[model samples]
Target: MVVAEIAEALDVRTWQLQEAKDQLSEVIETAQVRGPQMITRHGRPRAVLLSAEEYLAMTSDRPDFKEWLLGGPKANLALPESAFKATGEAKVEK
Candidate 1:
């Protein structure tokens, strides 16, 4: 879901957060099982509580630019022998 939607779904207002300070265990538990928990301040979203596993999963290794380019679409084109000549337009086969 989108960030705003998720925030609305698991929103914790400023005062509510203060009240739940002693019971943060529940917050942490819910955040882990139900996705990110949003903390709002003055009606604006301030922060989020995400499980470590989820955080790590989001930040996991990914292919670098070179690898991505190499793995991209391949073009199997045919060129005439004189295509590389210095004087005229290259002849390319469709």
Candidate 2:
């Protein structure tokens, strides 16, 4: 795999698909030590290999939809009086 010299500055290494596949262990080790390792196919970026710790750190704090909705600032909306006045078109009652 051709290691991208430019990516070195970012502490990331780019590996060709075949090279990364052939040396999967090394690639994983590199990701663990150096941050993220980018995998490329035909010179285009296809994926990134990240250490488990890095992956967890990136995803662990994300809240689910319900939690996110509940955690947001409360809205203090005031509905118009007409909104509470139901039209007598429906028969359902509490």
Candidate 3:
């Protein structure tokens, strides 16, 4: 695999994900000490192997959708009462 080119740029270990599957334990150990380990398929980057601590550190404290919207700028506008008005039209015709 063309891992050398990618690894040098990112300063991390690179592995062809399929070829490296047999040595997954070694990959995990390396990621714990060396930050992220890049995984590639068909010589293209596909994923990263990260330690649990690192994963949690990166993902923790993420805001949910409701919290995200609530934290944004408040709108000054209000819904118009006319928006709720019903149309005085017939439901059906013969």
Q: What TM-score does model 2 achieve against the real structure?
A: 0.71
lDDT of prediction 1? 0.67
Could you tell me the lDDT of residue 50 within candidate 1?
Answer: 82
Which residue ranges in model 2 land beyond 4 Å of their true spot? 1-9, 79-94
Clashes of 3: 0
Q: Rate the local accuracy (lDDT) of all candidates.
A: 0.67, 0.84, 0.83
lDDT of 1 by residue, 11-89 (tens): 6322245644766887788778877766655555567778899999997897888998999999878665676675576
The C-alpha stretches of model 3 lying farther than 4 A from their native spots are 1-6, 78-94
* TM-score of structure candidate 3: 0.71
- Of the two candidates 1 and 2, the one with more favorable TM-score, higher being better, is 2
Measured with C-alpha atoms, the lDDT of residue 1 in candidate 1 is 61
lDDT of 2 by residue, 1-94 (tens): 3446656666688899999999999999999998899998998778999999998999997999999999999987975555556653444355
Q: Which candidate model has the greater lDDT, 1 or 2?
A: 2
lDDT score for candidate 2 against the true structure: 0.84
Clashing pairs in 2: none
